[model samples]
Target chain A: MTLLAKNITLSYHQYEIINNLDLEINPNEITAIIGPNGCGKSTLLRGLTGLLMPAEGEVTLDGKPLQQWSKKTLAKQIAILPQNPSAPEGLTVKQLVEHGRFAHQGLFSKPTLEDAEVVDWAMQQTSVIDYQARLFNTLSGGERQRAWIALALAQKAKILFLDEPTTFLDIGHQLEVMELLKELNQLHNIGIVMVLHDINQAGNYANRLIAMKQGSIVADGKALEIITSELMKTLFNANTKIINYQHNGHQKSYCIPVGI
Target chain B: MKTRTILRGPKTNKRFYISVFALAITLVLSLFFSQIIGAAKVNITDFYDFFMAPNESAAQKIIGNLRMPRAIIGMFVGAHFAIAGLLLQAVLRNPLADPTIFGVSSGASLAVIASIFLISAIMPTTTFLTSADIPIFYVPFIAFFGALLATFLVFWLSWEDGNVNPKRMALGGVILGSIMTSAVMAIIVGFGQAKAELAIIWMAGSLYGRSYNNLIPLLPWSFICVIATLAIIKPLSVLRFDDDIAQSMGLNVKLWRMVAILISVGFAASAVSVVGPVGFVGLIIPHLAKLLIGGQMFKLIIVSALLGALLIVLGDLIGRSILVPLEVPIGAITSLIGVPIFLIILQKSGWKLK
Candidate 1:
């Protein structure tokens, strides 16, 4: 397994955050963790990245303990960008993207040709190359988020984690970020684990969906199989209707929740 | 497609280039002119003679022993304060944050004040080391401990529910710093003879009469602290993003924050020990540098250091030259010059509080 968690339990003081959670993430797939607010979705991603140690469990990446891996090694294998990343005033996109190469570049060594190439390619892939010289804070929310994604891509990690990448974006920008993630997964076969609030977006784009309620997974399977009306009601405490639609000549399933 | 491609190209290149060029020019001008502006007017020939061949004449003593050391120390201390300010501003994620704003300077000053007043009273016969006569090695050591105690106290008080909120942290620092500053003032007022001279000199922030001996002690410690900051530059840049985002990027947010704070405190402490709380260099230089060069850690460090060095050297020169025979304190000079420039920048930028 590229990443696996066994019997993971986490807590903050007396409140249990994640209780006896177990999961495995395969290579080259888009896995979406869907849940209502405060359902420990972010906490799970934190545990996977070794940011938060589970109270009573272990997370292993490539058969080695996650803690055993050095920060640089983990950084090279996995890149994550969370929601609403803040930058200091006047931070240019190029400079921000250059930070992703930190894990690969040594302290004394300057940026090599290959590092520059990767950074350039990452910017190109995310369509942020044109804004490379612009201050990050000056960009629109969507544009800024794209720059952050470009930074993560510069790491050239095989796996990427995103926490609510589309949170504050308008619908169009939301689609833009989603399309970028889809392209990264399809073109490079990168493993993607993202916490998504919008159930329809998750169902449409994710290969696998894991539904969580009150810090434990209630359903886990292929998107169509796991995102059932019963599961949606249990996970979100709302009645949901699943509908079929044709989008650009492709069949898509959309979920509409009612009576919160 | 063409429009999008063009939009993605380098946007702020012109501004960055101009700022860098300006910073370089200022550094050279400041360093060169500061040497000539001291109390005794030594011409260009005397400056060259002091540099090219030392001990040639007694006039060289005025340039070599006094002005030279003072200028170099000013430059180094200024660089340290500016870099520390940059780090603190980034860590707090607030533009207004500076080294003194976070109580680090006041912390060190309080410790020094206590050492001056209380330590002397406890041991009446023991000799108190003066900055000029004392061996240079011990100065930074005393300053480092004083700084460490103050920052530790700030850190301890600011911790609530296991997370450090930037706003609360700043408030805590301000409250503690004010308390310390008042205490130091009380001690200075209460002690009549032996403590008064040291207290007044430290409060005014003068670079006068500092020797190479005083500079040596601060050099190595400052170098280590600055180098440590360089190591964390990448992480710090990532941290500028929101906390969750930084963590997702595989940065250990809590650990990195602690590391940044520790290094910043060390730099501020060392600078304060030598330069005596030169203000606004820390508060304003980082913002000015950020405005000039975009906030890439690599570029920010270089530009902030250079700009800071330039400011201090200029402040020292103005302090010495403005009144001729009687010197103005370097701190007063810096505040007088820096505040106006800073306000202008703020006005032009149309900075609005978030």
Candidate 2:
């Protein structure tokens, strides 16, 4: 399965952000979109996931026009977790996750056994099963984020989109979330597309990296091929050094600034 | 095992049913209690005989003409306001959201008072006659329209980029409600003592001397709208999430919010038309229901209506009995009782908006 966007022009009140961009998200891969604050990484994510309609061009998921597909059908095929989502007070982790199964159930019917089983599986996958009883507000930031991930997992969608999933997380929690996304892609073959701020972390974890500068895609390829010093200088407008290393017989690249 | 401790499907269902049954009992008991105990003594035998035999004795007259209609109106109005409040709070995701906050009540107040002043001004001979001479049927119509007017102003003012902010709506509502309230006061002060007393009683959110005429017209709207609230329960639950997340979950957030708002307006306006903008029942009952049912969507939805009806009936009873000659307004009593309970819940929940 593939999600494709072509000639997409996204704007905020006449201010064009993503200008005539084209991209594709292939199935069963962890693709990370990274860019600076105003470079439109988040807007591009929103465009690709059908959160915002483009002023020009179109987006397609699995050979169907994104707008033509019913929202429920699209929901079953794709799940999205927005940045810094807030849940109602007194809502438990279990309750939050159960919301993901909304598209699966009949309009007025309660959750069936299958839905319950899916919620349980999601919790276990995210390792939030132990905290199911706790109110979402009482959980730590990382735990709360995982609970939201569990919610997305419960949707059982083939593709998942997250906007800055680890922005507020601590370093350890960030690594945990990145590893969790990688595991989801590898084990379940879910297409995971995320907007991440940390370029080094994106290069380390994601199989494919798409870097943007001022709403235009600067580089899109495997991490090692795309993380050259020239590309870093071109994209970030900063002089940076790139070093290659070997880990587990695989080559990896990291960006390092030249100055002290 | 996992479901038992957290979801606890069967156990939670059992608890919900038990509370429902308990609430149903209290509802009936309160209705019965409101009937038998009033300021005027009604012989129980006469009440029983009136049911069996058509008689015009003092006890039968008081029971049939006075207490029964008041109690029936209380049950339905209480239910209406509570459910309306619960829906508004849920849709807005703001605990402070309520019908009174939305200008519906005070708008109804202004409308009722304005209608009276207009009629009195038009016919100066009727100015000194109590509300009894002002024609009771018009207040319901005038008040309902007033509520609708208030809601329109609030929504129109709060609309921004095709989205309505609850904070803006709440702030707008409070301001509009206050303006209408102050207008009501101006009208009250413009009139003489007897008319002023009538206007004051109406503004206090009292259901004093309400008849079946008022209750009958509100029934079709309130009862049907209350049922319709259940139909939107699925979308309403989804609405608790932010817009982007709700949309991704296959919900039309804007459409559902509109539908929910319209339904809530219908419920609130109809009830307020009859009951002079009763307050706190809507604000307090949903929280009370949540405390009882633990926010499981179905149980929370159903139990809120039940508890709302129960609270209103009991509040009316307490209002009628407490001061004998001076009947406390049900609205005042609810706020008095509700404020303490609200504070306790706030203290317990730590008053977090999140």
Query: For each candidate, what's the DockQ?
Result: 0.37, 0.54
Q: For residues A1-260, what per-residue lDDT tens digits would candidate 2 score against the true structure?
A: 77899899998777899999988888788899987779998888888878888889999987887888788888888889999998876577888889999888776797799998999999998999887877778999999889989999998989999999998899999999989988999998888999988878899888999989999999999999998878877776778888899979988888887843
> After superposition, which runs of candidate 2 have C-alpha atoms over 4 Å from their true positions?
A229-241, A256-260, B1-7, B43-55, B112-144, B188-194, B352-354
The 0-to-1 C-alpha lDDT of every candidate, in the order given, reads 0.80, 0.83
Residue-level error in angstroms, candidate 1, position B339: 3.8
On residues B1-354, what C-alpha lDDT tens digit does candidate 2 reach at each position? Answer: 645454434555687899999999989888877878878887667767878996878888877878888888888888888888888888888888889988878877777778777777766643322344566655566777887788889988898766897888998999999988888898789774557775577677777877777677777786678678878878888888888898888777888888887788778877776777788888888898887867766677788888888888898889888899789998898899999998898888788664
Model 1, span A1-260: residue lDDT tens: 47999998877665789999999997689989999899999988888878777789899999898889877788888888766667656766887788788778765678899988898899999998877767777899999889988989988899999899999999999999999999999998888899999998898888999898889898898876777788878887889888878989877778887777
Tell me the deviation in Å of residue B46 in model 2.
5.6
In model 2 chain B, the worst 10-residue window by lDDT is B124-133
Where is model 1 chain B poorest over a 10-residue stretch in terms of lDDT? B125-134
TM-score for candidate 1, residues paired by index: 0.87
